[model samples]
Target: METLANLESFVRSAETGSFSAAGRRLALTPAAVSRNVAMLERNLGVRLFQRSTRKLTLTEAGERFLASIGGNLDALQAAIAAMSNDHGEPAGVLKVSLAPSFGVAYVMPLLPDFLQRYPAIRPEWHFENRAIDLIAEGFDAAIGGGFELAPGLVSRPLAPAHIVAVASPAYLRERTLPADPAMLNVMDGIVMRSGRTGRTRHWTMRDAAGNEVATTMRERIVVSDPAAMREAALLGLGVALLAVPDVLPWIERGELVRVLPRWYADAGAISLYYPTRTLMPGKTRAFIDHVVEAFRRDGLAQRLAGSLGL
Candidate 1:
């Protein structure tokens, strides 16, 4: 029988199309992953992958072998996890990805407690702004909004990603407070340009009274990042559309005020994303449970709701 490490390396390399990516997932060096795959090929006496400088493409035999063992690997891992749980504590490097601003403000605070509970687990966090391929990038988990749900991934919503209009108190002092989103056209607008499409995004705002209106803004300042938009609004540059969680602190501090309290754009849910494996690594499972519990205990879902912004 081949070693589990060798089989895992081959499967991960096939899934990611690169040894480096597989190594990232397995916490091995790229060379180590490559060696394991080679050893597996030697043991089987078959050429499994056509290796190139850029990527690894599986041969016909390799494809057949992958199809045969894919489900078995998941089951085997699950069994090993179950047995490990019975013998040891949850311990490993927990790799996760999250939005910089949101992660720092909310999730980072939970670190002390998480460490206290899972002393053997180490956190490897990547604070990034864009959506990432969880499996390909070897992220154990991710947290953010507006992520495309790739295959074998599941999303657990923590809060609504509702966009609210906001402006710094200093900026609004001299300007008229818009009663509605339509009136925002006359005001200086700090707007976001989509990173993928390279176009400014407009939104339609809705109220509790079932009223909906398309928002129009002057686009006086345009930024690719939400953090920049928030900063610009803080500098009294213009009104900005921001997620409720992003501006909630400033709004409570009296530094920023909601321009249209009754109106907000429904973006999506801020979610916890993970691969849909039958059983997960103990560290990953612990982290997910901890975050979910924290969100519930703090009432973050309700607090982050845009409809509650008034």
Candidate 2:
């Protein structure tokens, strides 16, 4: 019989398409992942993956084995969850993935309080702008902003995010603010390269009559990090389309000015997402409750108002 640990590694490697990526998800070294797969192969007496310089591919035998064992593996996971649910106390390490900027600006600050309240539960957090596969990556939950959600995941709205065009007072003084979207083509706008979306950021707006429009401005500075983009804007490098919560403090300090306020659009809701499972573990549930309450008390809208001196 294949060990559960080896089975797990095989499954993750198959799902992620590489042993290195599977190692990242499992917090193991690539060597260790390779060892696990080799051990499983030895036990089964058949090669699972065909090795190659450029890619890893499943063998016919491996595919057949995966088809046979997949449902059983899922059943075992459900059984364990059922057992944990009977304990009635949230206990375990809850792994969560979140956007780096939002995690820094909002979530991280409140985590200490949540940790204090839930002493039995531990959290392991991954902060990045990349979209990770929750099940393959072993994340309990993910926090992000978007309307289109991944299939087979459960998403719950945390709060609504508002996007605004902003520039430093100095930058505004140096350049004429575009009165219309057409004029934006000529303006030097700071564009963000999104790792998740794989495209340059575009500013979105809605007219007075509620017609949605998107404008892709010429990029003066293309940055990947939101914090860096905000800093560049503050230094009068260019105008930036930013989340309201991020630029509100600068606005309040008179360092930055909101531009074309009437044309800004609602970006969408920020959501907490997790793989759809039959029984959610106690630790995951407790974390979700804590996050929901934190948003209720200090949501993005309230943070924006306070930061902007509204």
Which candidate leads the pack in TM-score? 1
After the best TM-score superposition of candidate 2, give how far the Cα of residue 101 lies from its true spot, in angstroms.
1.7
Q: What is the TM-score of each candidate against the true structure?
A: 0.92, 0.72
Error of 2 at 161 (Å): 3.6
Global CA lDDT computed for model 1: 0.91
Model 2: per-residue Cα lDDT over 1-310, one tens digit each? 7777799788878877899888876767889999999999998899999988778889999899888886777677777777877865677778999987777778888789988877777888988767587766678889987624667689998765667778888888867788865567776889789877788978667665676767767789999877888999899888888877677778778888877766665777678998777777778877888888878876554665322323
Colliding pairs, model 2? none
Residues 164-213 of candidate 1: C-alpha lDDT, one tens digit per residue: 99998889888878788889899999999987899999999999997999
Q: Report how far residue 163 has shifted in candidate 1, in Å.
A: 0.8
Sliding window of 10 residues with minimal summed lDDT for model 2: 301-310
Write down the worst ten-residue block by lDDT for model 1.
Answer: 129-138
Error of 1 at 100 (Å): 1.3
lDDT of every predicted structure (CA atoms): 0.91, 0.78
